[model samples]
Target: MSLLTALGVEKRPSCNVSTTAVLVESQGCRSKDLVNITACSGACSTYTLYSAKMKALEHSCSCCQEVVTSERQIQLTCKDNTEITYTYIHIDTCGCLEVDCSPFAHSETTNTPSRMRSRRRRR
Candidate 1:
């Protein structure tokens, strides 16, 4: 039984193996137990599967020109056609992933603590 079917999802003819692979990994399915696929049927090794996921993320981030913000996020469609959400922190923390952060980096904010301290000194 395919992972989706095993999990009670109806098997659709249009769904591709790549989508299934991403869904399986993202769903936390164990790599060792690809459950339904036959052995030696060109199954992607766990390393390769995850590597592809990483590359897909990098490519998606590369194409993103939108402003990065905590409230602004991007959805990535994996080669398997499965979708995943990524936030600014998600892409920013991955130093290798390039994104424009100038807006957030240069935004001005008042120092509330210092302002409070000045008020206390005035009293």
Candidate 2:
């Protein structure tokens, strides 16, 4: 057992859910009357150490992710006094999941980003 663990040191969870108010703005419209957003926002364990089994360095990591999510729609008031509907993923539950730390496995997105899809409708 590790010294810290054997000494009775408390260990926090690697990842968990957190709630915060995030102002969402898009296409000159903003959401100021929205409720707080809940999402996975915790630090994950990452370390590198020497491994005797392989006689080399070893790396381990975990990342906070949304284990459960649901689609949610919100109305944003625009500057023109008009409103638009935006749909987004609401994180219902979150946890730490093992992930590949290789940059090749993870794609870096640039320029063309479509995070939130909004649609205007006629009433």
Candidate 3:
């Protein structure tokens, strides 16, 4: 199943030329899972799908100068026992496309913790 369908998102009529923006969250280096999809036409309407885990999120869409601006925020938990929260903004202009993907670590930072103190002191 398409990630959107897995997320329980209602599919909308495809634009003649449509750009898709997806944000995913997963555990550790594993394939990221699609958590949301936001599609828009340059006109004045946008479509959004929310997963069962994200029922209380908020989204907004606005159109200006043949550009569709869609902003969405969602919080998701992955099967790997990790939680990720993300916000994405998609701008579709003149049938052009732009996509941005960012992944974050869910664990506490140990990059410079005291466990390395002895090594640093010896240096």
Candidate 4:
């Protein structure tokens, strides 16, 4: 089973769910590495919209004063006023709030030379 399924959390298409508000309110029980935020709709809003690709820096929930990391989950408000709650899994030992892509295998063409060149040319 997938990680989400194993964790008993339903997997959504883009991590956009209604549970974000509830999670935000219960910050005390949340992990220090996780993140949670809200999205404001309408015009003249002062809060910044959340970006899925953006890495967490030093923002902390009002309820909890712990440092946010990539290993925790986050809630972000989108441009359309939608709230997205997703978990961020860290792949590297670095403490930076960034996505690590080193675990994935490199492309075959990029990692290895063409094997066809050693074969005899077609008559």
Q: Which candidate has the top score in lDDT?
A: 2
Higher-scoring candidate on TM-score, 3 or 4: 3
Better of 1 and 3 by lDDT: 3
List lDDT for all candidates, in order. Answer: 0.30, 0.74, 0.46, 0.34
Q: How close is candidate 1 to the true structure, as a TM-score?
A: 0.17
Note the residue pairs that clash in candidate 2: none
Tens digits of lDDT, candidate 2, 49-83: 66789997666667889999998888888999999
* CA deviation > 4 Å runs, candidate 3: 1-23, 26-66, 79-82, 92-123
- Model 4 per-residue lDDT at 86: 53
lDDT of 4 by residue, 1-123 (tens): 953356453332221112132433232333324333332122111112233567522221111111222465566555555656656543222111222323224665554355445667798
User: Which residue runs of candidate 4 sit more than 4 Å off their true CA positions?
Assistant: 1-70, 91-123
What TM-score does candidate 3 get on C-alpha atoms? 0.26
**Candidate 1: where is the Cα deviation over 4 Å?**
1-69, 89-123
RMSD in order of candidates: 22.8, 18.3, 23.1, 21.1
lDDT of 1: 0.30
Cα lDDT of model 3 by residue, 1-123, tens digit? 986567554444233324554546434322255544444444433335454686733343433232456676666666766666666664444332333222223446645454456534553
